[model samples]
Target: MKEFLCTDKDFKDIAALVYNACGIVLGEHKREMVYSRLARRVREHRLKNFSEYLAYLNSNKDKEFDAFINAITTNLTSFFREPHHFEFLKHTIVPQLLNSNKVAKRVRVWSAGCSTGEEPYSLAITLADLFPSSWDVKILATDLDSNVLAKAQAGIYTAANVNGLEDKTLKKWFLKSKDGHTYKIKPKLNKNIFFKRLNLLQDWPMQGQFDLILCRNVVIYFDKETKDTLFKRYANALNNSGYLFLGHSESMGKEHSEFKNLGKTMYQKQHNARTV
Candidate 1:
């Protein structure tokens, strides 16, 4: 491997490009992090340094750009990474939605920024455990990074990925590979999940509203204005009385008439009638 030099100018230019392309605000401090990620791309393209890489990026408008975004985007998630949210879903949210005649029997969940499938899969497992019957359940798992989306769609994981799951849950929801080194989500669990590469900053192609939207730990990277815009979009994307789960550090700013904080980074859509 050769020593790759990334100038201050190069870092700033790349950071600006990233912010303009997506809403992710990479602060000046992220220069080293950016270098660490994109350096491989720079080498893969056989470029001399970061300057040449940025030059290439400026000239291209194709898959490489997607590759660039995929390389830089952070994807840190696991099955029930935020366990309390799943608990809330299983204990309170799902039961009420399913039992209420006023609400639709069908359930729709969007795992926005679903990295490598853990969040949506956990939701699937929870629903499967709770319902256990033939129910109309659809989960749309989307991420800006196509690479992670590919991995998410595969529904496969290493043994470590299933670490904290209960034995019965593991046996019921995942099938151990013949070698016992990998586990794949059972087909039944995979059926309801629809994985797609979706940039949250871009227009959402899906038409129907979601009953639950888990955009956890995602908007923390966005600026305040971007967060406000995205939260409003989340409000619009959810059905009446739907729930929005944010990252622990993220909030809905001041109270919005459309949504009421249910605490623990959960917000309920305020319709004509409050149901939570």
Candidate 2:
């Protein structure tokens, strides 16, 4: 009715809405960010106001809540992100795996919140480089957003996707499209990687027990309680000496006893031999 600008109440109301819908907590300082992100929903819905849209979200019997969450959760990632983590995966983790014939034979890596494919593709390339001829590499990349998963499965990306790659690496791993602007990972590179649509809120499909899990920058949007629950579940899913990689900002902290830090944001399964 009146000219609308998002207010504190609007921000709190949205925070509550998002939390209920997806377990994300929009904290106090995020008032402006909440406003900025939801403003588009207002314009798109052409509602009378923020209050009206909020009401609509509340009353709808069944809506595409995943799409709503995907709309808000920022999906920013790149190939070989936090390169040191991959380095650790290669040099430190894989060396231990090599010693144990049981764990070394087959490697299972889960890119928990793989955005548009770069992260998992990066893992595949790293595996190709680090453990070539190791046909036992099985990589699973997942995202809650079906839209992003679709793009991830296709493995084709615009020029912007190659953000931090060297020309030599790009030339080695990607094939420029006939049009010359787009590129895709060569099919040979796709062997180890599989992309699937998954939501962290839902029960994980596979009986995990994975060698490594990469849930980087994913749960930053989730509330603390949700984070604890997810991380505990993650711990359970890992093998006795498996590893977990969180975003530089997302730390396991003292909350979970199942893991110990391995420098940087990297963590090791409690049973693993200590790193110097």
As for candidate 1, its clashing pairs are none
Q: Assess candidate 2 and give its lDDT.
A: 0.79
Tell me, what's the RMSD of every candidate? Answer: 2.7, 3.6
Candidates in order have lDDT scores of: 0.86, 0.79
TM-scores of all models?
0.94, 0.86
* Candidate topping lDDT: 1
Cα error, residue 58 of model 2, in Å, equals 3.6
lDDT of 1 by residue, 192-276 (tens): 8999888888888989988899999899889988888888888888887889999888888764667889999999988843222
Q: Where does candidate 2 have its weakest 10-residue lDDT segment?
A: 60-69
Instruction: Write down the RMSD of candidate 1 (Cα, Å).
Output: 2.7
Candidate 2 lDDT over 7-33, as tens digits, reads 667668777767875677778877666
Worst 10 residues of 1 by lDDT: 97-106
